[model samples]
Target: MHILQPRHIRLKKEEAEELLKRLNISVSQLPKIFITDTALPEGCQKGDVVRMERKYEDKIYPYYRVVVGSLNEKKNG
Candidate 1:
């Protein structure tokens, strides 16, 4: 949402599945992102996958993260 921040998009269930298959990695193997992260899109919850689009040089690269509950919440809930 910021000028310098990468765009984050929450992937649907089917898309997430396809991505995992294409990458040959499970959701747990992907990087983790907290649900409380400011850049995460609304409605994101635990087990959701987010795609981040970052521009470098003349091309854009895609990065993925699996949403997890906040540490604090994990401890309390």
Candidate 2:
């Protein structure tokens, strides 16, 4: 991990649902994060949601991304 990069966190099912509720969107509508992303926490699986707290210029931004298998991974069944 980069010195300045925040850790990528996996969310529990409840937390993931809460995040989706806050955004008024379903997990399928969320952005994708490649499974190979270095920040991804170990043991994370496809279709999981990750929370990344990015820090820049002393500001911390919260970002939620859905883990996907590949660049063209499908979001819906």
Candidate 3:
């Protein structure tokens, strides 16, 4: 049986805009996370935006990350 997992989802266009407004950062400024993560839902693609929700204290917090290519595929400086 599956035990626990982090909440992962793609934001709608409007939601993405709201997040950017709240964070004061652009999409490129957001950090990258793995789309291949087992805790994530399938069908995620590179460059897709992902929102991760975590519960802490008495409230749930949302974090945003972008899907990126594997380490082996990263461009070298």
Candidate 4:
């Protein structure tokens, strides 16, 4: 799954694309955010935006964020 960071949140690519379709907007139109977590799931890469889904009670929410590299590892050496 692709990862994304947008406005203090992280999401997967599939989720992001779905959100774009639902919201009727492109990814560039969304707010800019960074992935602050270091222990992201495996295969998450730098510069990749991830889309995710959240459920609260009976309600579901979708969001996206940009993967600005890992806080624990250095992408550039």
**Maximum-lDDT candidate:** 1
* Index of the highest-TM-score prediction: 1
TM-score ranking, high to low:
1, 2, 3, 4
Candidate 1 worst ten-residue window by lDDT: 1-10
After the best TM-score superposition of candidate 2, give how far the Cα of residue 44 lies from its true spot, in angstroms.
Answer: 0.6
> Would you give me the overall lDDT of model 4?
0.57
TM-score of each model, in listed order: 0.93, 0.81, 0.72, 0.44
| Cα lDDT of model 2 by residue, 1-77, tens digit | 88878868899999999888988999999899889787799999988999899888888888888988965555543
Model 4 CA lDDT for position 54: 63
> Which stretch of 10 consecutive residues in model 3 shows the poorest summed lDDT?
1-10
- Residues 1-77, candidate 1, lDDT per residue (tens digit)? 78789999999999999999999999999999998999999899999999999999889999999999999997998
Tens digits of per-residue lDDT for model 4 on 19-52?
7798898767665344556444556666566655
Better of 1 and 4 by lDDT: 1
CA lDDT of each candidate?
A: 0.95, 0.87, 0.77, 0.57
Rank the models by lDDT, top first: 1, 2, 3, 4
What TM-score quantifies how close candidate 3 is to the native fold?
0.72
Off by over 4 Å in 4: 1-39, 70-77
